[model samples]
Target: MNEENNLEQPQETLGQALKKRREETGMSLEQLAGALKLSVLQLQRLENDEHELLGPATFVKGYIKSYCRELKIDSQAMLELLPEHVEPAKKSKMQSFSRRTEKEANDSRLMLFSYFILAVIIGSSVFWWWQNSNQNIEEPVTTVMPNQLESSDISPDLAVAAPAEETIIQPEADVPTTSNETQSQVAAQPQTEKADPEHSEVVMHFNEDSWVEIHDGNGDRIAFGVKKAGYIMKVTGPQPFNVVLGKHQVVDITFQGETIDTSHFAKNRLAKFTLPLTE
Candidate 1:
């Protein structure tokens, strides 16, 4: 019976209680605002009972609680002084705004997913069409007439003529040569044998641009520079040659008439090796 009577009695509002406590503590609004890390205008609005100007009922309740704590009073009892309908009216607009923002984000994600699916479908269709077109183009258009088929099925024992054996006349072992031919042969023999025995050829066929540097056993720089694509370079140098290549995959190196497989020796797209690779 006493609890009901106490509930029926009019109670001091939260703002009025907070203002009375602040005055009892001998603290100005500015001093309290600085202590609570709040602006003086917000403190004034809180003390003056301006809940509408404080943004939200939740924030207003928080400010009241902080003010109660600073004054060393019961924050829960102070919070209970707020009207029951205050939060419902004030928070409705915030809840609606939050819901609207969430809806917009969801819509954007759905739209992006729809575009991705559409692009995938379009790409798949194009690929399928291309495959079909290629198959259609590759198929041969061939037809066989009945008369041609009958002609092709001739009797095997009707004495079909065998193709005439080619006749190849064999040359005599000893053929007399003219004076000019004998002299030309004699001159060509020395020219062929005149190749330098001290030098070996290092050939590089470049399919892409690559920088190459080469040094022979004699410490002579035989080749150095950036070789362009499709350029075939041949350097004749002494054996046990030192070679360096920028972008080893771009160039095919052939030493002593054999292509070297230096791709495995490459590191960071560069290769360094010696010609006539030792065991």
Candidate 2:
């Protein structure tokens, strides 16, 4: 019956007792907090008995002892009445959970951004392909049959199109079909000619612009011509032929395809150059 009566009585919490003591000493929260060199929130939490919010048991006990000393209360008495401090394990778990949730949110945002960028790239590629295909489809057809153009009634702009001129294949009569050896064989055919076996002849090869004359020993004119550069002329006559040259340096004479040395007469520009046709 006595214990029940004790339980029924109004019990003062550790915070309420400290608040009463502080007020009796004529100390406000700010004054008490300033004298204790503590924050107003810290003092308020201590007075309100929010020991769990203030952190670990040792720290809360220290703050309470400081408050009691500042308010001139019993520090040991207030500490004995305070509740147990919360466990650090629970706080650690809460922090881990908060970090995990934040990390998950950031990962989700990154995945969504990646998906958005991928979708844009795919959409752009598909749009470009579609546009390119449409351009290919809309392009004009330029090739037509030659017979169709000749038989059908054509537009004036298209009628001016000469299919015969554009598509007609010319006959390859003079066109060389074989290799370059065939061309060399064809070029050698005209320069081949037989000379008389009895009386030997002289051949003059012209390499520049020069007036020349060639006559036999019988005073018969065999050849007389004005030759330009790269002109190959054959003036064949009897032995001891008289060969006149306007420019002696520009002419090259040969007997039986052998070069005749005309360097002895190199000083005289105009002279009768002799030809030893036999040897």
Candidate 3:
């Protein structure tokens, strides 16, 4: 009965047994800590059975096992004496792996989202560039000055004539009058015209510096230039000439001796119309 009672008594904890075994091997705390690659504070905690201070239940179990290995003691026997509340090392490793996997999954989703945003930005940039390129191709503008005008733009039959000298005729007054009356009579007399009314095909009188381009029925550019103010130009081309004028407010056009009303066709200070303009 006494022997059975003694056998039923409580055994020392895993930490206490490890410490006793280490002392029997004549190894100091520093020497054991160095061999096990553990700090002296950690080794002291383990020897003192400070399970809470040592860290998690899993870490305490690992320290206990390492202590048994260095002391050359049986680890299985000592491990059985651990508290039931302590978790197993396998369970701890599995929990760590699960958390790492969750973190990696979140990172993967973030990366995919970043790629989606980048793709949208690139697509928008390319679309904007494409739209601008098409706009440039569709509407084209040409600028030409009189001095830089090419000979090819003018037809050979369309010769530019110089302005003729004016021959003023003084009307004879039947009776001598005041000087103001004489001046009024001279002002009433008309100045000579630069263009021939009966023979001219197309005539342009510029009130300011203006840009003009004319294409004939056969698509030939008969005359195009930036004409100076008070300048008169005559051009002979096929019927139904295509004309574009920049600053139409500063020009007058007469086709085949009939005045052209360009106010209806003017837009944003420019005019585009066909000669012999249809109603």
**124-168: candidate 2 lDDT, tens digit per residue:** 999999999999787543323222222123323333322222121
Clashing pairs in 1: none
Candidate 2 residue 10 Cα shift, in angstroms, is 4.3
| Candidate with more favorable, higher TM-score: 2 or 3 | 2
Model 3, residue 262: distance off in Å is 30
Candidate 2 positional error at 39, Å:
4.5
Alpha carbon lDDT at 87, candidate 1:
45
Instruction: Work out the TM-score per prediction.
Output: 0.31, 0.43, 0.36
Candidate 3's TM-score reads 0.36
Over the stretch 134-168, how does candidate 1's per-residue lDDT look in tens digits? 99787543223211112122223211311111111
After TM-score superposition, what is the CA distance of residue 143 in candidate 2 from its true location, in Å? Answer: 1.5
* lDDT (Cα atoms) of all candidates against the true structure: 0.70, 0.67, 0.69
Cand. 2 Cα-lDDT:
0.67
